[model samples]
Target: MRSNIDGKRLVDRIRKYYKADDFQVSDDGLSVGKDFYGLNKIKRVEVRQLGWRENAVNIVSLALVLSAATWAFVPQFGLIALALTFVIGFSCWRKYELRAEFIGTDETGDHWVAIARGCTKEEYSVFKEVERTMRNQV
Candidate 1:
Protein backbone atom coordinates (compact mmCIF):
# COMPACT_ATOMS: atom_id res chain seq x y z
CA MET A 1 0.00 0.00 0.00
CA ARG A 2 2.98 2.24 0.56
CA SER A 3 5.05 3.68 -2.25
CA ASN A 4 7.36 6.64 -2.50
CA ILE A 5 5.57 9.67 -3.92
CA ASP A 6 7.24 12.38 -5.95
CA GLY A 7 6.32 15.38 -3.89
CA LYS A 8 6.86 17.89 -6.69
CA ARG A 9 4.85 15.95 -9.25
CA LEU A 10 2.03 15.32 -6.87
CA VAL A 11 1.88 18.94 -5.88
CA ASP A 12 1.84 19.99 -9.52
CA ARG A 13 -0.98 17.62 -10.35
CA ILE A 14 -3.03 18.89 -7.41
CA ARG A 15 -2.34 22.49 -8.33
CA LYS A 16 -3.70 21.94 -11.81
CA TYR A 17 -7.19 21.67 -10.35
CA TYR A 18 -6.82 23.37 -6.99
CA LYS A 19 -5.28 26.83 -7.03
CA ALA A 20 -5.19 27.20 -3.27
CA ASP A 21 -1.98 28.67 -1.90
CA ASP A 22 -2.19 26.82 1.40
CA PHE A 23 -1.90 23.30 0.01
CA GLN A 24 1.52 21.73 -0.44
CA VAL A 25 3.25 18.39 -0.13
CA SER A 26 6.53 18.36 1.70
CA ASP A 27 9.05 15.86 3.00
CA ASP A 28 7.59 16.12 6.45
CA GLY A 29 3.92 15.84 5.53
CA LEU A 30 1.00 17.25 3.56
CA SER A 31 -0.25 20.73 4.25
CA VAL A 32 -3.86 21.69 3.56
CA GLY A 33 -4.91 25.15 4.51
CA LYS A 34 -3.68 25.75 8.06
CA ASP A 35 -3.51 22.07 8.95
CA PHE A 36 -0.31 20.07 8.69
CA TYR A 37 -0.42 16.27 8.79
CA GLY A 38 2.84 14.46 9.09
CA LEU A 39 3.52 11.77 6.51
CA ASN A 40 3.96 9.10 9.13
CA LYS A 41 1.08 10.44 11.18
CA ILE A 42 -1.49 9.99 8.43
CA LYS A 43 -3.21 6.72 9.23
CA ARG A 44 -5.54 6.63 6.24
CA VAL A 45 -6.54 8.33 3.03
CA GLU A 46 -9.99 7.60 1.66
CA VAL A 47 -12.84 8.74 -0.57
CA ARG A 48 -16.08 8.89 1.34
CA GLN A 49 -19.62 9.58 0.14
CA LEU A 50 -21.70 11.69 2.48
CA GLY A 51 -25.42 11.06 2.46
CA TRP A 52 -28.51 12.58 4.10
CA ARG A 53 -29.83 9.25 5.29
CA GLU A 54 -28.31 9.93 8.67
CA ASN A 55 -30.61 12.96 9.03
CA ALA A 56 -33.61 11.51 7.28
CA VAL A 57 -35.67 11.30 10.43
CA ASN A 58 -34.95 14.87 11.35
CA ILE A 59 -35.76 16.12 7.87
CA VAL A 60 -38.99 14.17 7.77
CA SER A 61 -40.04 15.48 11.14
CA LEU A 62 -39.31 19.07 10.18
CA ALA A 63 -41.19 18.70 6.92
CA LEU A 64 -44.21 17.30 8.70
CA VAL A 65 -44.22 20.05 11.32
CA LEU A 66 -43.84 22.84 8.78
CA SER A 67 -46.49 21.42 6.51
CA ALA A 68 -48.93 20.95 9.36
CA ALA A 69 -48.31 24.43 10.75
CA THR A 70 -48.77 26.06 7.38
CA TRP A 71 -51.82 24.00 6.58
CA ALA A 72 -53.44 25.07 9.82
CA PHE A 73 -52.77 28.73 9.07
CA VAL A 74 -53.58 28.76 5.35
CA PRO A 75 -54.46 25.93 2.98
CA GLN A 76 -52.54 27.42 0.04
CA PHE A 77 -49.40 27.86 2.09
CA GLY A 78 -49.49 24.18 2.88
CA LEU A 79 -48.82 23.49 -0.78
CA ILE A 80 -45.93 25.89 -0.59
CA ALA A 81 -44.61 24.05 2.39
CA LEU A 82 -44.84 20.74 0.54
CA ALA A 83 -43.06 22.21 -2.47
CA LEU A 84 -40.34 23.68 -0.30
CA THR A 85 -39.90 20.38 1.44
CA PHE A 86 -39.42 18.57 -1.85
CA VAL A 87 -36.95 21.14 -3.10
CA ILE A 88 -34.92 20.97 0.07
CA GLY A 89 -35.03 17.19 0.15
CA PHE A 90 -33.99 16.82 -3.49
CA SER A 91 -31.16 19.32 -3.07
CA CYS A 92 -29.85 17.65 0.04
CA TRP A 93 -29.99 14.23 -1.59
CA ARG A 94 -28.32 15.36 -4.78
CA LYS A 95 -25.66 17.32 -2.95
CA TYR A 96 -24.43 14.28 -1.09
CA GLU A 97 -24.95 11.62 -3.74
CA LEU A 98 -23.25 13.41 -6.61
CA ARG A 99 -19.97 14.30 -4.93
CA ALA A 100 -17.16 12.30 -3.36
CA GLU A 101 -14.78 13.65 -0.74
CA PHE A 102 -11.11 12.87 -0.32
CA ILE A 103 -10.03 12.75 3.30
CA GLY A 104 -6.81 12.13 5.20
CA THR A 105 -7.10 10.87 8.75
CA ASP A 106 -4.33 11.51 11.21
CA GLU A 107 -3.92 11.36 14.97
CA THR A 108 -5.76 14.61 15.57
CA GLY A 109 -8.60 14.21 13.06
CA ASP A 110 -9.54 13.97 9.40
CA HIS A 111 -8.39 16.55 6.90
CA TRP A 112 -10.24 17.08 3.61
CA VAL A 113 -8.37 19.24 1.14
CA ALA A 114 -6.71 17.05 -1.47
CA ILE A 115 -9.29 17.27 -4.25
CA ALA A 116 -11.99 19.44 -5.71
CA ARG A 117 -15.56 18.41 -5.07
CA GLY A 118 -18.33 17.37 -7.55
CA CYS A 119 -16.07 14.37 -8.00
CA THR A 120 -17.10 11.75 -10.56
CA LYS A 121 -15.67 8.30 -11.09
CA GLU A 122 -12.56 9.71 -12.75
CA GLU A 123 -12.13 12.09 -9.86
CA TYR A 124 -12.62 9.18 -7.52
CA SER A 125 -9.85 7.29 -9.29
CA VAL A 126 -7.62 10.31 -8.84
CA PHE A 127 -8.49 10.33 -5.15
CA LYS A 128 -7.63 6.66 -4.90
CA GLU A 129 -4.35 7.30 -6.68
CA VAL A 130 -3.51 10.04 -4.25
CA GLU A 131 -4.46 7.81 -1.37
CA ARG A 132 -2.18 5.08 -2.66
CA THR A 133 0.66 7.50 -3.17
CA MET A 134 0.23 8.93 0.30
CA ARG A 135 0.00 5.48 1.83
CA ASN A 136 3.21 4.51 0.16
CA GLN A 137 4.92 7.63 1.35
CA VAL A 138 3.81 6.88 4.86
Candidate 2:
Protein backbone atom coordinates (compact mmCIF):
# COMPACT_ATOMS: atom_id res chain seq x y z
CA MET A 1 0.00 0.00 0.00
CA ARG A 2 1.15 3.56 -0.66
CA SER A 3 2.02 5.77 2.30
CA ASN A 4 -0.45 8.51 3.19
CA ILE A 5 1.94 11.34 2.20
CA ASP A 6 2.65 9.72 -1.14
CA GLY A 7 -1.05 9.23 -1.77
CA LYS A 8 -1.78 12.88 -1.05
CA ARG A 9 1.00 14.00 -3.35
CA LEU A 10 -0.26 11.75 -6.09
CA VAL A 11 -3.79 13.13 -5.70
CA ASP A 12 -2.46 16.69 -5.86
CA ARG A 13 -0.57 15.88 -9.03
CA ILE A 14 -3.69 14.46 -10.65
CA ARG A 15 -5.59 17.57 -9.64
CA LYS A 16 -2.96 19.71 -11.27
CA TYR A 17 -3.09 17.61 -14.39
CA TYR A 18 -6.83 18.16 -14.91
CA LYS A 19 -7.36 21.87 -14.41
CA ALA A 20 -10.75 23.39 -15.15
CA ASP A 21 -12.24 26.87 -15.63
CA ASP A 22 -15.34 27.01 -13.38
CA PHE A 23 -17.16 24.83 -10.85
CA GLN A 24 -19.66 24.61 -7.97
CA VAL A 25 -18.20 24.29 -4.50
CA SER A 26 -18.67 20.97 -2.74
CA ASP A 27 -19.73 20.36 0.89
CA ASP A 28 -16.15 19.66 1.96
CA GLY A 29 -15.11 23.26 1.12
CA LEU A 30 -12.69 21.86 -1.43
CA SER A 31 -12.75 23.17 -4.99
CA VAL A 32 -13.58 19.99 -6.84
CA GLY A 33 -12.97 20.17 -10.59
CA LYS A 34 -15.96 20.35 -12.94
CA ASP A 35 -15.92 19.42 -16.58
CA PHE A 36 -17.35 22.61 -18.13
CA TYR A 37 -17.44 21.26 -21.68
CA GLY A 38 -20.23 19.13 -20.21
CA LEU A 39 -21.28 15.96 -22.02
CA ASN A 40 -19.93 17.22 -25.34
CA LYS A 41 -16.30 17.03 -24.23
CA ILE A 42 -16.80 13.62 -22.69
CA LYS A 43 -16.42 10.56 -24.87
CA ARG A 44 -16.40 6.91 -23.98
CA VAL A 45 -18.08 7.84 -20.72
CA GLU A 46 -19.27 4.98 -18.52
CA VAL A 47 -20.43 4.35 -14.98
CA ARG A 48 -18.70 2.17 -12.44
CA GLN A 49 -19.81 -1.43 -12.11
CA LEU A 50 -21.06 -2.63 -8.75
CA GLY A 51 -18.02 -4.18 -7.09
CA TRP A 52 -20.10 -5.79 -4.36
CA ARG A 53 -22.10 -7.75 -6.93
CA GLU A 54 -18.93 -9.04 -8.63
CA ASN A 55 -17.58 -10.04 -5.23
CA ALA A 56 -20.74 -12.04 -4.55
CA VAL A 57 -20.29 -13.98 -7.78
CA ASN A 58 -16.68 -14.69 -6.83
CA ILE A 59 -17.69 -15.92 -3.41
CA VAL A 60 -20.11 -18.40 -4.97
CA SER A 61 -17.36 -19.65 -7.30
CA LEU A 62 -15.06 -20.11 -4.31
CA ALA A 63 -17.75 -22.08 -2.47
CA LEU A 64 -17.96 -24.35 -5.48
CA VAL A 65 -14.18 -24.77 -5.35
CA LEU A 66 -14.32 -25.88 -1.69
CA SER A 67 -17.12 -28.26 -2.48
CA ALA A 68 -15.08 -29.72 -5.34
CA ALA A 69 -12.15 -30.10 -2.95
CA THR A 70 -14.18 -32.11 -0.47
CA TRP A 71 -15.78 -34.19 -3.16
CA ALA A 72 -12.34 -35.00 -4.60
CA PHE A 73 -11.81 -37.48 -1.75
CA VAL A 74 -14.76 -39.50 -3.06
CA PRO A 75 -13.68 -40.40 -6.65
CA GLN A 76 -13.33 -38.95 -10.16
CA PHE A 77 -14.03 -35.51 -8.71
CA GLY A 78 -10.29 -35.26 -7.94
CA LEU A 79 -9.21 -34.53 -11.49
CA ILE A 80 -11.86 -31.88 -11.82
CA ALA A 81 -11.04 -30.60 -8.34
CA LEU A 82 -7.88 -28.72 -9.30
CA ALA A 83 -9.47 -27.47 -12.50
CA LEU A 84 -12.46 -26.08 -10.70
CA THR A 85 -10.24 -24.34 -8.16
CA PHE A 86 -8.28 -22.69 -10.97
CA VAL A 87 -11.28 -21.67 -13.06
CA ILE A 88 -13.70 -20.65 -10.31
CA GLY A 89 -11.33 -19.35 -7.67
CA PHE A 90 -9.26 -17.47 -10.20
CA SER A 91 -12.32 -15.80 -11.68
CA CYS A 92 -13.31 -14.72 -8.18
CA TRP A 93 -9.93 -13.17 -7.58
CA ARG A 94 -9.79 -11.50 -11.01
CA LYS A 95 -12.98 -9.47 -10.68
CA TYR A 96 -12.36 -7.76 -7.36
CA GLU A 97 -11.81 -4.06 -8.20
CA LEU A 98 -13.82 -2.96 -11.22
CA ARG A 99 -14.27 0.78 -11.71
CA ALA A 100 -15.05 3.19 -14.53
CA GLU A 101 -13.55 6.56 -15.41
CA PHE A 102 -14.19 9.19 -18.09
CA ILE A 103 -11.24 8.58 -20.40
CA GLY A 104 -10.97 10.92 -23.40
CA THR A 105 -8.32 10.37 -26.06
CA ASP A 106 -9.14 12.31 -29.17
CA GLU A 107 -7.29 15.01 -31.17
CA THR A 108 -6.13 16.52 -27.87
CA GLY A 109 -4.98 13.12 -26.73
CA ASP A 110 -5.87 11.80 -23.24
CA HIS A 111 -6.43 14.61 -20.75
CA TRP A 112 -8.72 15.00 -17.75
CA VAL A 113 -8.89 18.02 -15.46
CA ALA A 114 -11.33 19.70 -13.14
CA ILE A 115 -11.99 23.35 -12.39
CA ALA A 116 -12.06 24.19 -8.72
CA ARG A 117 -15.42 25.13 -7.23
CA GLY A 118 -16.22 28.85 -6.88
CA CYS A 119 -16.04 31.57 -9.56
CA THR A 120 -14.08 33.92 -7.33
CA LYS A 121 -10.98 35.64 -8.69
CA GLU A 122 -8.59 33.92 -6.30
CA GLU A 123 -9.99 30.48 -7.07
CA TYR A 124 -10.00 31.20 -10.79
CA SER A 125 -6.39 32.32 -10.62
CA VAL A 126 -5.35 29.09 -9.03
CA PHE A 127 -7.64 27.00 -11.22
CA LYS A 128 -6.59 28.75 -14.39
CA GLU A 129 -2.95 28.49 -13.45
CA VAL A 130 -3.30 24.74 -13.04
CA GLU A 131 -5.27 24.46 -16.26
CA ARG A 132 -2.59 26.43 -18.10
CA THR A 133 0.07 24.13 -16.75
CA MET A 134 -1.91 21.06 -17.86
CA ARG A 135 -2.60 22.46 -21.30
CA ASN A 136 1.03 23.37 -21.75
CA GLN A 137 2.01 19.84 -20.86
CA VAL A 138 -0.32 18.60 -23.57
Candidate 3:
Protein backbone atom coordinates (compact mmCIF):
# COMPACT_ATOMS: atom_id res chain seq x y z
CA MET A 1 0.00 0.00 0.00
CA ARG A 2 1.23 3.49 -0.81
CA SER A 3 1.17 6.28 1.71
CA ASN A 4 -1.35 9.08 1.24
CA ILE A 5 1.36 11.52 0.24
CA ASP A 6 2.78 9.10 -2.30
CA GLY A 7 -0.64 8.56 -3.75
CA LYS A 8 -1.18 12.26 -4.10
CA ARG A 9 2.13 12.64 -5.87
CA LEU A 10 1.29 9.76 -8.17
CA VAL A 11 -1.99 11.42 -9.09
CA ASP A 12 -0.22 14.64 -9.86
CA ARG A 13 2.29 12.85 -12.04
CA ILE A 14 -0.47 11.07 -13.88
CA ARG A 15 -2.36 14.28 -14.50
CA LYS A 16 0.74 15.89 -15.96
CA TYR A 17 1.63 12.81 -17.97
CA TYR A 18 -1.79 12.68 -19.56
CA LYS A 19 -2.01 16.47 -19.97
CA ALA A 20 -5.37 16.43 -18.24
CA ASP A 21 -6.98 19.82 -17.86
CA ASP A 22 -8.20 19.39 -14.31
CA PHE A 23 -7.08 16.50 -12.18
CA GLN A 24 -6.80 17.44 -8.54
CA VAL A 25 -6.48 15.50 -5.30
CA SER A 26 -7.95 16.76 -2.09
CA ASP A 27 -8.85 15.62 1.40
CA ASP A 28 -12.41 14.65 0.43
CA GLY A 29 -11.82 13.11 -2.97
CA LEU A 30 -10.02 13.26 -6.29
CA SER A 31 -10.97 14.63 -9.65
CA VAL A 32 -10.28 12.51 -12.72
CA GLY A 33 -9.28 14.83 -15.54
CA LYS A 34 -12.72 16.42 -16.03
CA ASP A 35 -14.91 14.33 -13.71
CA PHE A 36 -14.73 14.45 -9.95
CA TYR A 37 -15.73 11.53 -7.74
CA GLY A 38 -16.00 11.92 -4.03
CA LEU A 39 -14.25 9.27 -2.00
CA ASN A 40 -17.50 8.16 -0.42
CA LYS A 41 -19.24 7.93 -3.77
CA ILE A 42 -16.61 5.86 -5.54
CA LYS A 43 -17.58 2.21 -5.93
CA ARG A 44 -14.87 0.75 -8.15
CA VAL A 45 -11.85 1.56 -10.30
CA GLU A 46 -10.70 -0.98 -12.85
CA VAL A 47 -8.57 -1.39 -15.96
CA ARG A 48 -10.37 -3.03 -18.86
CA GLN A 49 -8.26 -4.88 -21.38
CA LEU A 50 -9.60 -4.43 -24.88
CA GLY A 51 -10.36 -7.71 -26.61
CA TRP A 52 -10.04 -8.65 -30.29
CA ARG A 53 -13.82 -8.30 -30.65
CA GLU A 54 -13.56 -4.63 -29.66
CA ASN A 55 -11.40 -4.00 -32.74
CA ALA A 56 -14.04 -5.00 -35.27
CA VAL A 57 -12.36 -3.19 -38.12
CA ASN A 58 -9.12 -5.00 -37.48
CA ILE A 59 -10.94 -8.30 -37.39
CA VAL A 60 -12.70 -7.60 -40.66
CA SER A 61 -9.43 -6.54 -42.29
CA LEU A 62 -7.70 -9.71 -41.13
CA ALA A 63 -10.55 -11.84 -42.45
CA LEU A 64 -10.52 -10.04 -45.75
CA VAL A 65 -6.80 -10.54 -46.15
CA LEU A 66 -6.98 -14.23 -45.24
CA SER A 67 -9.90 -14.84 -47.61
CA ALA A 68 -8.15 -12.87 -50.28
CA ALA A 69 -5.32 -15.40 -50.10
CA THR A 70 -7.73 -17.95 -51.59
CA TRP A 71 -8.34 -15.56 -54.50
CA ALA A 72 -4.65 -15.70 -55.47
CA PHE A 73 -5.62 -16.93 -58.97
CA VAL A 74 -7.33 -13.59 -59.63
CA PRO A 75 -4.21 -11.38 -59.82
CA GLN A 76 -5.78 -7.92 -60.09
CA PHE A 77 -8.60 -8.57 -57.59
CA GLY A 78 -6.23 -10.26 -55.16
CA LEU A 79 -3.75 -7.37 -55.25
CA ILE A 80 -6.49 -4.82 -54.73
CA ALA A 81 -7.99 -6.72 -51.83
CA LEU A 82 -4.57 -7.16 -50.20
CA ALA A 83 -3.72 -3.47 -50.62
CA LEU A 84 -7.03 -2.29 -49.15
CA THR A 85 -6.78 -4.74 -46.29
CA PHE A 86 -3.22 -3.58 -45.50
CA VAL A 87 -4.26 0.05 -45.25
CA ILE A 88 -7.32 -0.70 -43.10
CA GLY A 89 -5.44 -3.11 -40.89
CA PHE A 90 -2.58 -0.68 -40.32
CA SER A 91 -4.90 2.17 -39.43
CA CYS A 92 -6.92 0.04 -37.07
CA TRP A 93 -3.82 -1.30 -35.36
CA ARG A 94 -2.45 2.21 -34.87
CA LYS A 95 -5.69 3.37 -33.27
CA TYR A 96 -6.07 0.33 -31.01
CA GLU A 97 -5.93 1.11 -27.28
CA LEU A 98 -6.84 -0.19 -23.81
CA ARG A 99 -8.74 1.88 -21.29
CA ALA A 100 -9.21 2.34 -17.57
CA GLU A 101 -12.68 2.95 -16.18
CA PHE A 102 -13.92 4.58 -13.03
CA ILE A 103 -17.21 3.14 -11.79
CA GLY A 104 -19.15 5.01 -9.14
CA THR A 105 -22.68 5.61 -7.90
CA ASP A 106 -24.42 8.84 -7.05
CA GLU A 107 -27.93 10.16 -6.45
CA THR A 108 -29.00 9.07 -9.92
CA GLY A 109 -27.45 5.63 -10.37
CA ASP A 110 -24.28 3.68 -11.00
CA HIS A 111 -22.21 4.89 -13.92
CA TRP A 112 -18.76 4.51 -15.35
CA VAL A 113 -16.29 6.78 -17.09
CA ALA A 114 -13.10 6.14 -18.96
CA ILE A 115 -10.28 7.80 -17.05
CA ALA A 116 -7.46 6.86 -19.40
CA ARG A 117 -6.81 5.13 -22.70
CA GLY A 118 -3.49 4.16 -24.27
CA CYS A 119 -1.35 1.33 -25.65
CA THR A 120 2.02 2.17 -24.10
CA LYS A 121 3.77 0.66 -21.10
CA GLU A 122 3.96 3.93 -19.19
CA GLU A 123 0.29 4.62 -19.72
CA TYR A 124 -0.55 1.11 -18.54
CA SER A 125 1.45 1.66 -15.35
CA VAL A 126 -0.48 4.85 -14.78
CA PHE A 127 -3.73 2.92 -15.15
CA LYS A 128 -2.65 0.39 -12.56
CA GLU A 129 -1.57 3.10 -10.17
CA VAL A 130 -4.82 4.97 -10.55
CA GLU A 131 -6.78 1.79 -9.93
CA ARG A 132 -4.72 1.00 -6.84
CA THR A 133 -5.12 4.49 -5.44
CA MET A 134 -8.88 4.61 -6.00
CA ARG A 135 -9.34 1.09 -4.66
CA ASN A 136 -7.50 1.98 -1.48
CA GLN A 137 -9.65 5.05 -0.97
CA VAL A 138 -12.87 3.18 -1.49
Candidate 4:
Protein backbone atom coordinates (compact mmCIF):
# COMPACT_ATOMS: atom_id res chain seq x y z
CA MET A 1 0.00 0.00 0.00
CA ARG A 2 1.20 3.49 -0.70
CA SER A 3 1.72 5.83 2.22
CA ASN A 4 0.05 9.26 2.48
CA ILE A 5 3.41 10.85 1.76
CA ASP A 6 3.66 8.92 -1.49
CA GLY A 7 0.18 10.05 -2.53
CA LYS A 8 1.04 13.64 -1.69
CA ARG A 9 4.15 13.43 -3.79
CA LEU A 10 2.15 12.06 -6.70
CA VAL A 11 -0.40 14.90 -6.41
CA ASP A 12 2.45 17.37 -6.33
CA ARG A 13 3.88 15.85 -9.48
CA ILE A 14 0.55 16.05 -11.33
CA ARG A 15 0.02 19.65 -10.29
CA LYS A 16 3.49 20.57 -11.44
CA TYR A 17 3.13 18.69 -14.71
CA TYR A 18 -0.30 20.22 -15.50
CA LYS A 19 0.17 23.74 -14.30
CA ALA A 20 -2.79 25.94 -15.28
CA ASP A 21 -3.63 29.60 -15.24
CA ASP A 22 -6.15 28.82 -12.48
CA PHE A 23 -6.59 25.92 -10.04
CA GLN A 24 -8.68 24.80 -7.12
CA VAL A 25 -7.77 22.56 -4.17
CA SER A 26 -10.13 21.00 -1.62
CA ASP A 27 -9.59 19.28 1.73
CA ASP A 28 -10.82 15.98 0.28
CA GLY A 29 -7.84 15.98 -2.10
CA LEU A 30 -9.72 17.33 -5.12
CA SER A 31 -7.72 19.56 -7.43
CA VAL A 32 -8.54 20.97 -10.84
CA GLY A 33 -6.84 23.25 -13.28
CA LYS A 34 -8.74 26.08 -14.92
CA ASP A 35 -7.49 24.70 -18.20
CA PHE A 36 -8.77 21.22 -17.35
CA TYR A 37 -11.58 21.86 -19.82
CA GLY A 38 -9.09 23.15 -22.40
CA LEU A 39 -9.69 26.41 -24.25
CA ASN A 40 -13.43 26.13 -23.58
CA LYS A 41 -12.92 25.38 -19.86
CA ILE A 42 -15.28 23.17 -17.85
CA LYS A 43 -18.24 25.22 -16.65
CA ARG A 44 -19.85 22.34 -14.82
CA VAL A 45 -18.69 19.38 -12.74
CA GLU A 46 -20.43 16.08 -13.26
CA VAL A 47 -20.20 13.01 -11.04
CA ARG A 48 -20.34 9.91 -13.16
CA GLN A 49 -20.30 6.26 -12.12
CA LEU A 50 -17.91 4.74 -14.60
CA GLY A 51 -16.15 1.32 -14.99
CA TRP A 52 -18.71 -0.92 -16.68
CA ARG A 53 -16.28 -1.77 -19.45
CA GLU A 54 -13.55 -2.69 -17.01
CA ASN A 55 -15.90 -4.83 -14.95
CA ALA A 56 -17.07 -6.64 -18.05
CA VAL A 57 -13.49 -7.30 -19.18
CA ASN A 58 -12.53 -8.61 -15.76
CA ILE A 59 -15.47 -11.02 -15.82
CA VAL A 60 -14.53 -12.30 -19.24
CA SER A 61 -10.86 -12.70 -18.36
CA LEU A 62 -11.78 -14.59 -15.20
CA ALA A 63 -13.80 -17.08 -17.22
CA LEU A 64 -10.98 -17.63 -19.67
CA VAL A 65 -8.36 -18.05 -16.94
CA LEU A 66 -10.50 -20.56 -15.02
CA SER A 67 -11.18 -22.62 -18.14
CA ALA A 68 -7.48 -22.72 -19.02
CA ALA A 69 -6.57 -23.61 -15.46
CA THR A 70 -9.02 -26.48 -15.42
CA TRP A 71 -7.26 -27.96 -18.46
CA ALA A 72 -3.73 -27.42 -17.13
CA PHE A 73 -1.75 -30.58 -16.44
CA VAL A 74 0.20 -29.09 -13.52
CA PRO A 75 -1.68 -28.92 -10.21
CA GLN A 76 0.47 -25.99 -9.07
CA PHE A 77 -0.52 -23.95 -12.10
CA GLY A 78 -4.14 -24.75 -11.40
CA LEU A 79 -3.82 -23.41 -7.88
CA ILE A 80 -2.25 -20.16 -9.09
CA ALA A 81 -4.91 -19.81 -11.73
CA LEU A 82 -7.64 -20.33 -9.16
CA ALA A 83 -6.17 -17.55 -7.01
CA LEU A 84 -6.15 -15.15 -9.93
CA THR A 85 -9.70 -16.13 -10.84
CA PHE A 86 -10.90 -15.32 -7.33
CA VAL A 87 -9.27 -11.90 -7.43
CA ILE A 88 -10.90 -11.09 -10.74
CA GLY A 89 -14.30 -12.34 -9.59
CA PHE A 90 -14.12 -10.21 -6.45
CA SER A 91 -13.23 -7.15 -8.46
CA CYS A 92 -16.16 -7.72 -10.79
CA TRP A 93 -18.62 -7.89 -7.91
CA ARG A 94 -17.12 -5.07 -5.88
CA LYS A 95 -18.87 -1.73 -5.61
CA TYR A 96 -17.09 0.84 -7.71
CA GLU A 97 -16.75 4.50 -6.77
CA LEU A 98 -18.13 7.27 -8.93
CA ARG A 99 -15.70 9.17 -11.17
CA ALA A 100 -15.63 12.94 -11.71
CA GLU A 101 -15.25 14.52 -15.12
CA PHE A 102 -14.97 18.10 -16.30
CA ILE A 103 -17.06 19.09 -19.36
CA GLY A 104 -17.12 22.35 -21.31
CA THR A 105 -15.95 24.03 -24.48
CA ASP A 106 -13.63 26.95 -25.16
CA GLU A 107 -13.00 29.24 -28.10
CA THR A 108 -10.05 27.03 -28.95
CA GLY A 109 -11.69 23.62 -28.30
CA ASP A 110 -13.45 21.27 -25.88
CA HIS A 111 -11.78 20.04 -22.65
CA TRP A 112 -12.36 17.38 -20.02
CA VAL A 113 -10.55 15.66 -17.16
CA ALA A 114 -11.13 12.61 -14.95
CA ILE A 115 -10.08 13.70 -11.52
CA ALA A 116 -10.21 11.23 -8.59
CA ARG A 117 -11.53 7.75 -7.79
CA GLY A 118 -11.97 5.44 -4.76
CA CYS A 119 -14.72 3.53 -2.90
CA THR A 120 -14.63 5.86 0.05
CA LYS A 121 -16.74 8.67 1.46
CA GLU A 122 -13.80 11.00 1.17
CA GLU A 123 -13.57 10.28 -2.50
CA TYR A 124 -17.25 11.00 -3.03
CA SER A 125 -16.96 14.18 -1.01
CA VAL A 126 -14.12 15.33 -3.19
CA PHE A 127 -16.42 15.27 -6.21
CA LYS A 128 -19.11 17.22 -4.40
CA GLU A 129 -16.60 19.73 -3.13
CA VAL A 130 -15.19 20.25 -6.58
CA GLU A 131 -18.66 20.85 -7.98
CA ARG A 132 -19.45 23.36 -5.27
CA THR A 133 -16.17 25.13 -5.72
CA MET A 134 -16.58 25.36 -9.46
CA ARG A 135 -20.11 26.73 -9.16
CA ASN A 136 -18.89 29.42 -6.80
CA GLN A 137 -15.61 30.20 -8.55
CA VAL A 138 -16.66 30.15 -12.20
Predictions in order: lDDT: 0.54, 0.43, 0.59, 0.52
Residue 5, candidate 2: C-alpha displacement in angstroms? 24
lDDT of 4 by residue, 1-138 (tens): 579889868755653332222245433343454323332244445555556676667676886778576757666577667667767665444232323334433464534455544444545565565556655544
Pairs clashing in candidate 3? none
Highest-scoring model, lDDT: 3
lDDT of 2 by residue, 18-136 (tens): 23333332322223343233333433222122255655676666767676766766666665665666566443332111111234655756563322232234544554454443333
In model 4, the clashing pairs are: 37-111, 39-106, 40-105, 40-106
| After superposition, candidate 2 runs with Cα above 4 Å error | 1-49, 74-138
Better by lDDT, candidate 4 or 3: 3
lDDT of 1 by residue, 1-138 (tens): 133467656644654332334346677876655666676655555555545673475467767888898999998889889778866654333211112133445565544443333224554455555556566666
lDDT of 3 by residue, 15-118 (tens): 44442233455667777666666766556767776665656666676958665784776766776676677665654432223233334345666666555555
In candidate 4, which residue ranges exceed 4 Å CA deviation? 1-40, 50-54, 57-112
Model 2 weakest 10-residue run by lDDT: 93-102
Better of 2 and 3 by lDDT: 3
Off by over 4 Å in 1: 1-24, 32-36, 49-117
Best by TM-score: 3
TM-scores for all candidates: the values are 0.37, 0.22, 0.45, 0.36
Where model 3 places Cα greater than 4 Å from the true spot, the runs are 1-24, 57-109
Candidate 3: RMSD to truth: 12.7
